[model samples]
Target: MTVLLTGCSQGHSPFIPMLGAYFPYWMLCTFIGLLGAFCLRVLLIYWGIDDKLPVPLLFYFAIMLSISLTISLLYFTY
Candidate 1:
């Protein structure tokens, strides 16, 4: 995703430079999204959303994955 994001821009453009400058910011967003999904899973389990684990994680990951895709799309379009 990083490579795609970076490669989508022309080498000498100001926008490309700014995108490169904030590469870590994108990484941070990815990490935060995954972490948020994990924490939400634990909270849901504590609240008895399910009597077992694993499957609920599928849902969590799906949600987070969609969010990550959205962020990437926004970055791409911007």
Candidate 2:
């Protein structure tokens, strides 16, 4: 049982220190991803494509998730 739990502590924590506080790396990625999604939404609205999506909310949410995962993979390792 102890051996099985040992793997849990093997990797470095992805916390970052900022202004005397520790923030999870995923938080940053998600925030950036959200901003990207919002910007994309604005552009899509401007271009008249936002109304064409069958499921706009879910599509934007997926885009946000993809952006977050991509940023995490490119910059951090688990």
Candidate 3:
């Protein structure tokens, strides 16, 4: 993930060609990240975290981090 983000940050560089070629892979990573986070949330809820607001806050934080990371990676590659 760090490598992808670093590559994305290097705009117009030759390295970006490789990133563009693997756009689908990057997208898949994003999807997987989202899915994993969701599953974690569900597990937390199943363990009784749902009764408190902190659970939602944690979920939101995870989502926000995922989005930011994805965007940062995209920008780095492009």
Candidate 4:
């Protein structure tokens, strides 16, 4: 049996450079996700609908993951 791999390269860096320093892309994605979650939470709270969520904490977590993964995919994928 044999396995083949293709189109894999080490030419990409997962770090974003700024101010002569580098930050992980994952961290940036998480930050963006957290911000999104915070905004959504605020909107729900303002509408007095936050209490209606079945699982508020889990919902926020899901939202964070969704946002982070979407951003990562959009930014990193070719």
lDDT of 1 by residue, 1-78 (tens): 687687546652323234446453456557767877888777877999766665775888887887766765676443
Candidate 3 lDDT at 38 equals 75
Backbone-clash count (model 4): 0
* Residue pairs with clashing backbones, model 1: none
**Model 2 per-residue lDDT at 75:** 88
- Score every model by TM-score: 0.50, 0.83, 0.42, 0.81
- Model 3 agreement with the true structure over 1-78: per-residue lDDT tens digits: 677766445344433234447353445556656766777678767998767755687766677568647765776444
In terms of TM-score, the best-performing candidate is: 2
Q: In order, how many clashes per candidate?
A: 0, 0, 4, 0
Colliding residue pairs in candidate 4: none
Write model 4 residue lDDT over 17-68, tens digit each, in one string. 7678988789989999999999999999999999999999999999999999
Candidate 3 residue pairs that clash = 8-76, 8-77, 9-76, 9-77
Instruction: Give per-residue CA lDDT, model 2, range 1-78, as digits (tens).
Output: 887776446366678787899798899999989999999999999999999999999999999999999999998775
Best by lDDT: 2
Question: Candidate 2: misplaced stretches above 4 Å?
Answer: 1-11
Please identify model 3 stretches exceeding 4 Å from their true place.
Answer: 1-22, 55-58, 61-78
RMSD of each: 6.3, 2.4, 8.7, 3.7
